[model samples]
Target: MTFFRAFCIERSAPATREALCGRFLSLDETALDAGDVLIRVECSSVNFKDALAATGRGKVVRRFPCVGGIDLAGTVLRSAAPRFAPGEKVIATGYELGVAHHGGYAERALLPGGWLLPLPASLSSQESMAIGTAGLTAAMAITRMEENGLKPERGPVLVTGASGGVGTLAIDMLAGRGYEVVALTAKAEQADWLRGLGASRVMLRSELPLDAFKPLDKGIWAGVIDNLGGATLAWALSTSKPTGVVASIGLAADSHLSASMMPFVLRGVSLLGIDSVYAGFSVRERAWARLAADLRPRHLASIMRIIPFEALPQVFGEFIAARATGRTVVQIARSGETEDMT
Candidate 1:
C-alpha cells in the first residue's frame, strides 16, 4: 500500500469540550472516498472557510477526520469518467470538497468528474491557487453583473473588504475592465495596496457611518460587489444607482439584513447572490474562461504568497483573524511529480 500526506482533523469520539485538533498524517489511497477522477495535487490555496473547517472555528466540515482545502489545481492521475484522462491538468473547487469529502490539503484528491474544470491555458497551477475560491467568487460576481447590463461606462463599482482575497481580485478585475473601483476597507494601512490593485479610491469602513444610514442615500455606486454583509451590504443597496446590480458574495460582516424594500422597489436595485460553490457546470466554465481571458490578474506576483503544505496549520489563524493579505498558495507537490504519477 502506498501512503500520502494528508492534514486531518478529529474531535473526541465520545464528544467532549476538548477542541478538535488537526495534524499531518499519512493516509492510504483507499481512505479517500470513491470518486471518478484521481488527482495528484500540484497545489492548493487557503480560503476563509478552510480556516473555519481546519480550526473548527465554524462547522464548515460536516464530517470528522477530514482534510481542509476547498480549492486545488492539479493534474489528473487516473480517470474513470469520460470527461477526463490521466495526466490532464485540472482544477476543482466548491462542491463537497473539504467538507463532506477529503480535500486538496492532501497530496492526492479523488473527486467526481462533475466537480472538475479544465485549468485555463492562461493560468498555471500556481496562478489558479492564487485566485482559488475567492477569485472564482469575484469573477462570478462580475459575470452576473455584466449579464444584467452592467457596463464599464456606467460608473464606479464598490467592493467592500478590499484588502481580502475577493476584494483585491475584484478590484483588479473591475479596474482591468476599465471600470472605476471604489474599495472599502477598515485597513487604512492597506489603502495604497488596494489602490495598487486598481482601486480608484479607498474608503475606510469606520467612515461609512453605519449607525446612521438612510433607506436611500446618494446613488454613488453604479454597481456594488459586496464581500461584507450586514450594514455594508444594506448600505450598498441603499446607495446604488437606480437599476444597478449589487452582487452579494460574503457575509463576513453579519448575515442578517435589516432593511426595507425601498432600495429594491423604489430605487430599482437588484441584489445578485453569487455562490461559487455548487454553481452550475456551465457557469463554472464560463467564469474560468473569463478568468483566463479578460479577468486574469496582471499583478499576480503581488497577490500571491507560496508556502509549503506543512505551514497550513499555523496559517489558518491568519485567515481567522482576517490578517491574511491577497492569497496564499500551498505547494503540495512539484509540477513534475503532479504530471507524472507512478
Candidate 2:
C-alpha cells in the first residue's frame, strides 16, 4: 500500500458554491475505487471536456469530489489483468473516466484493465499526453475519412477549427499522408503556425458565410474534418464535392444544424458522427497504432504547453474560455519517470 498527494475539491458553504475550492490532500492507495490495474499518473492533458468539468460547468461531473481529467499517461504499478504488467507505460482516455469515476488529476489512479492501452513505442508518456484525446480523435477522423474513400489523389481536404488540438493534428496528419490540407481557423495570428504544421492553405472562419442556407454551393473540398459543428458543418456539407465525406467530431460552436439535405441526396455527401467515449477497443487500438505510425505529427511537441499540476485549475479556465491554444499538458510527476496512478 502507498499514499500520495492529490487535489480535492471542497465545497465549504452552500452560499459559497461559486467559491468551491481545491486543495492538496494526502490520499492512500485504499482510497482508490476497485479496479484490475494500479497506475502512477505521470501526466495528464486538458481537453475542452476537462476544462468544463474543472470549472463546474456543462454538467460534466455527475458526482462531487471527483478527480477531473479525461486523459492520462503513466506506468503500470500493478495489474491483475493478463495483458499488462507492472513497469509498463500505458494510457487511458474516455469510457466514463473523469466523469462518473475518479480520474487522472491524482498522482495515482485505479482503472479497469480493459480501459488501458500499452503506451505506443513511438510515443513517450509526455508525447502521449500531448496527443491525448484530441490527437486520438484527429486520427480517428482521418481513419473514418479514408474508410469513406478519402483518397490522396482527390482534391484538397479541409480541417475546420484548425488552430485547436484536433484540428492542428488533423492538418498535420492529412498533409503528412499526401493530401492538400486547407486549415480553417478564426485565429489569424496562428496562420504561420498552422502553415508550419503542413497546412497548404489557411482560411479565416469569418470568411465563411454560414447564414446563407443554400441547398447546395460550389463543391470545393474532397473531404473535411469538422471539429466545430453547427454552421461550419452545414457549410461544409453544402460545399463538399460529390461523394465527399465529413467527420463531425465536436460541437464547439453549437450543436444544431440548420441546413437543407440536398447535398446528402444529390451529391452523395456523408456526415459521419464520431465519439471517442464508446469507441470499441479494436477501433481504439487501430487509431492509436496509426497515431504511432503515419499520423504522428512531427510538430507535436512544439504545439504543446507543459505546466505543473498546481496550475491545472488556471490553465483549465483558459481552455474553457477559448484563450488556450494547441495542447496543454499537466506534469504530475517528476520528469522522465512514469507514475502509475491506476
Candidate 3:
C-alpha cells in the first residue's frame, strides 16, 4: 500500500470546545472516499470557503475528516468512468469537493469523473489552480450577464471586494473585454494595484454610505459583480442603472439582504445568483470555455502567488482575516513530477 499526505478536517474530541480541527495526516488509498477517477493532484488553490472550512470559522464542511481543498488540477492516474481516461490533464472545482468529499489538499485525489473537466490547453496545472473556484465564479457571472444583454458600452461595472481573488480576476476579465470597471475595496493602499488590474476607478468600501441604503439612489452602475453580500449588495442594487445586471457570487460579509424592489420594478435591474457549486455540467463547460478565451484574466501573473503544499496550514488565517489578496496556488506535486507519475 502506498501512503500520501493529506490535510484532513475532523471533529475535535468531545472535550474540546471547537467543533472541528484540521491537521495533516498520512493515508493510503483505503482512506480516501470512493470515486471513479483517481488523480495525482499537482496543484490546488485556497478560496475563502476553503479557509472557512479548514479553520472551523464557517459551516462549510458537511463531512468529518474530509480533505480541505475546493479546487485542484491534476493528471488522471485511472478512471472507471467512460468519459475520462488515464493520463488526461483535468481540473475540478466546486460541487462537494472540500465540503463533503475528499478534496485536493492531498497528493492524490479520488473523485467522480463528473466533477472534472479537461484542462484548457492554454493553461498549465498551476494556472488552472490559480484561477480555481474564484475565477470560475467570475467567469460565470460575466457570461450570464452578457447573455442577458450587458454590453461594455452600457456603463461602468462595479466589482465589490476588489482586492480578493474573484474581484481581481473579474476586474481583469471585464477590462480585457473593454468594459470600464470600478473596484470597491476597503483597502485604500490597493487602489493603484486594482487600477493596474484594469479598474478605471477604486471606491473604498468605507466611502460608500452602506448604513444609509435608499430605496432608489441615483443610477450609477450598469452592472455589478458583488462578492460581498449584505449592505454592499443592497447598495449595488439600489444604485444600478435601468436594465442593469448584478451577479451575486459570494457572501463574505453577510448573507442577509434588506433592500427595496424599486430597482427591480422600476429600473428593471436583474439580480443573478451565481452558484458555482452544483452548477450543471453545461454551465461549467460554458464558463470554462469563456475563461480560456476572452474571459481569461490579463493580469494573472500579478494576481497570483505560489506556495509549497506544506505551507497550506499556515495560510488559512490570511483569508479569515481578509489579509490575502489575488490568488494563492498550492504546489502539490514536486517540480517536474505532475506528468511523471512514476
Candidate 4:
C-alpha cells in the first residue's frame, strides 16, 4: 500500500570487488523491478537457491542489489499481458527470477507475464509456496519415470535424499501412485517422519552400498528418484533393476559422478536429469495439475515450516549449512489486499 519491505543483497564498495550485504529495505512501486506484470507477493519460499543468493554462499545471483527468493505466489496488482488481469491470483517461479532478475523476497514483485501460472484450484498461495520448485521437480521425476516404463507392478521404488524437500515430496507422490517406496537418508532420527510421508522402509547411508556395489548388483528397484548426485547416484544406478529409470534432480551432496558404464550397458539403466527451471509452460502446468490431484500431500503442514520475513537470515544459514530439512515458506506480504481478487 505505502512503502514495501524487502530482503535483498546489494552490491557495495569498489565495483571490481565482489562485496555484498544482505538486509531489509523499504521500497515503493518505483523501486520494484520492471516486468509486464506487478504482483503483491503474498508468499515467497526459501529454496536452496534462494538461500545461496541471500547468504551469498554460492554463485546463484548474477546481479547485484537483487531480491532473494526463487518462488512466489500472489495477486496481480497490474498486468500488461492479455493472459492476466488485475486481482488475479498467480504463481511465479524458475526462469531468471531470483538470479539474473530481481525476485520475490519483497512485499511486491514485478515478474514477466510468461513466468506466471494461475494458482491451481486446489492450492492456496501458502500451499503453492510450500510445494514450490521442489514439488515441481518431484512431479517431473515421477512423470519421467512413468514415461520410461516404470510401473508400480514391477517392484519397489527407491528415493534418495529422503529427508529433503524433493525427496519427501517424491516419496509422497510415488507412494500415492501405488508404488512401494523405500527412502534413503543419512539422518536416522527422521525415519518416522519419512515413513509418514509414505516410505515403506527407511535406510540410513551406511545401509547402502549394501556390501559394495559392482557394475550391476541386483534388480531391487523398479524406479529411483534421486536428489543427491555423486556416489549416491552411482549407487542407485548400480543397484537398480534392468530397464530401471532413475530421475536425478538435485546435487546437494557432490556434483561429480564416479561411476562406470556397466550399469548402463549391462542393466539398460536410464538416468534422466530433472530440471525444474525453464521448464516449458505445458510441462509446468501438467506438473502443477498432478500436484493438485494425485501428488497433493496428505501431510502438507508436516512437510512445511513457515517463518516470517524477519527469520530469513537464520533460515538461509540453516539451508547453507545443510541443517534444514523439508520446505520453508516465507510470509512476505502478510496483509495482501486480495478481498476482491478473483
Specify the highest-lDDT model's number: 3
Please give, for residues 10-72, the per-residue lDDT of candidate 1 as tens digits: 753313222335789999998998799999898999988887777776677888888878999
- Sort every candidate by TM-score, greatest first: 3, 1, 2, 4
Q: Rank by lDDT, highest first.
A: 3, 1, 2, 4
Across 1-342, the per-residue lDDT of candidate 2 in tens digits comes to 667767654433323323334556789988777799988898999898877666666677776677778899988888998999898989999987888777888998999998999999989988999899999898898899899999989899999988888888888888899999999999999999999999999999999887775779999989999988888999999999999999999999998988788999999999988898879899899999999998888888778989998877667667666777889888988656544334
User: lDDT of each structure?
Assistant: 0.88, 0.85, 0.91, 0.85
Q: What ranges in model 3 sit over 4 Å off?
A: 13-20, 338-342
**Native-referenced Cα lDDT, model 1:** 0.88
- Candidate 2 residues lying further than 4 Å off, grouped into runs, are 9-23, 335-342
Compose the digit string of candidate 4's lDDT tens values, residues 213-255. Answer: 7867767888998888888888888988889999999898889
Stronger candidate by lDDT (2 vs 3): 3
Model 2's C-alpha root-mean-square deviation from the true structure amounts to 2.5
Clashes of 2: 12
Off by over 4 Å in 1: 12-20, 334-342
Question: What alpha-carbon RMSD in Å does predicted model 1 have with respect to the real structure?
Answer: 2.3
